[model samples]
Target: MGVDDQSTLQPMDDTAWTFLDGRIDAVLTTVRAESADRAAQGQALTALITSLG
Candidate 1:
């Protein structure tokens, strides 16, 4: 779940993938938080895409 605006130079490693789970968890948490706070789906989705980026 890691990338830069520049070219993909340094390849991703296995260790980096391990942290991907936590990143996904955080994105879900943010989505839930937005819903709990009555935020619009658009806002939640924005957060989701931002996390993936």
Candidate 2:
């Protein structure tokens, strides 16, 4: 779905979050230097991860 398609998104349960977080870490480890857009995305994901705690 598109970024603007909020209607299709739903919040996951705590169990799902725990599962996804590990997978996300695995994917994130492969990430390297890129453009400012990726930097912005990293910042935003960091904020979301922080909010879950």
Candidate 3:
């Protein structure tokens, strides 16, 4: 799914992860969210590093 598609998804609750289909859209969605969060963290760290230089 595209990034625009992801914007329409409601944030999953903890229990929602347990009932994922065998096709695992929930797993993929969670992974994508995590990857986006990590990317944001990396950008924040990079900014800090640049500021320290």
Candidate 4:
């Protein structure tokens, strides 16, 4: 979707908004899950490093 003006707000279709909202939600969920997994792995690595040292 392209915007006509930066300052002016244009009316958008309800269905378009709904579709965009769903897509954004899916992206957010995926990002959150990946971040959680990365954090857990980092904690485990830190624990292992401390034990080795």
Please give the lDDT score at residue 44 for candidate 3.
54
Instruction: Give per-residue lDDT, candidate 3, residue 41.
Output: 53
Per-residue lDDT of candidate 3, residues 1-53 (tens digit): 75434333324433432333322543345446734676555555554455435
- Note the Cα lDDT for every prediction shown: 0.54, 0.54, 0.44, 0.51
CA deviation > 4 Å runs, candidate 1: 1-14, 34-53
| Runs in model 4 lying further than 4 Å from the true structure | 1-11, 34-53
Per-residue lDDT of candidate 2, residues 12-43 (tens digit): 35565556566566446545435335665576
TM-score of each: 0.34, 0.34, 0.32, 0.42
Q: What is the clash count for each candidate, in the order shown? A: 0, 0, 0, 0
RMSD of each: 8.0, 10.3, 15.1, 15.1
TM-score of structure candidate 2: 0.34
Q: Highest TM-score: which candidate? A: 4
Q: lDDT per residue, candidate 1, 1-53, as tens digits?
A: 33652234234554554455456565577666734644554565565566568
* lDDT agreement of model 3 with the native: 0.44
lDDT for position 40 in model 1: 51
Candidate 4 versus truth, CA RMSD in Å, comes to: 15.1
Output the lDDT of residue 50, model 1.
69
Q: Supply candidate 4's per-residue lDDT for 28.
A: 54
